[model samples]
Target: MNTSTSGTTKNYRVLLVGDEDNSARLILNTLHKVGLECRYAVGAAAGLSAFRENNIHLVLLDLSTPTAETLCARIRENSTKPLLMTTAATDHQVPLIGLKVGADDYLLKPLDPPMLIARVFALLRRVYVYGGDESHVAKAPPSYSDQGSRLPEGWATCEACNYMGPSPRFEGRSRHGQSVMVCPHCRVPAAVTYAVS
Candidate 1:
């Protein structure tokens, strides 16, 4: 899975919260294959502490952990970062409650590595790449904008045609709910910007 866009690879950090060390290791190995860095926490307290102390970009929570729900809710209160949950329980309500408490996605354990990787990538793309929330981007240094660029802050330079203008000039959304900016000059989806409230 090449997670790069526009020839740049994002160094996204993931936090794995669970008591199951073997499961956590498995997940870390899978994510590492695609260039994601991960941190592991054995319980809710440790998870919360790690989340606060580190520059975590996303979270993978094992719902079977006794305190998973509490950790999930607390993390949601602190940040809008994507949270993916996994559990072995077949009870549908377990996942339902997890979502209600703020998980972005849930999976059943005896986990499928491919599906897990896909979901992680999807959430990262939606929230960090195409979603374009300034809060998330602010943590990472500017990758596109550079000191030599004449474009003003909040302006976008089209990747396809070099059309430069305020982000609104290229504003639009994709059918999948991604916030995309289409280049008016070349009719290509060119950029993503934080939507002003």
Candidate 2:
């Protein structure tokens, strides 16, 4: 079920796709405490629908999700938001497959609430704040690189690789910031600086 952020502004919206009622409940409580609104779906199809219908921020998936890869693919088609997956304790082998299918991180089942919140915060920091093109620490997560990012209006993409950084939306002058769109990894200007015909 979806609810507007009433008491406090909902910082993040999460979708958990699986049948783990207990885990889902725990996650919901943790997320709400941190100003994140988390909603769960029982299966893959419902999960996809919920994701599409709402303004979701992050996604937590259970490896046992029906059509897990398919669900991931569908979500990736529209948004580049972070996706974290949880697998059984002995399922170290699953992250490889999960990554290939577009999942960003994987954790063992029986969610550790603290660690889960940390990962979610980290993921949100990277996705919501860090520009998509950012790769290096200064331009991405591990650091505070707000220099080249369009920041919290226009889209800025690194010319070097597939990395992209999305600016948070706000009203006012379209010129949110400089955001030269440079490569975070190489620290080089994003576009060609040389003369062109």
User: Candidates' lDDT values, in order?
Assistant: 0.71, 0.62
Candidate 1 lDDT by residue in tens digits, 6-106 = 21345677888888567777888877765666788888888898889877888999998888999999998968899999999888999999999999999
Question: Candidate 2's C-alpha lDDT?
Answer: 0.62
1-197 in candidate 2: lDDT tens per residue? 43333215424577878875677777777666655667788788888998888767789888787798889888898878889998884856667888887999988877877567657756876676654533312332212121221211233333443233432211113255654435443454533121112
TM-score of each: 0.64, 0.62
Clashes of each: 0, 9
Q: Which run of 10 residues does model 2 get worst, by summed lDDT?
A: 143-152
Worst 10 residues of 1 by lDDT: 1-10
Clashing pairs in 1: none
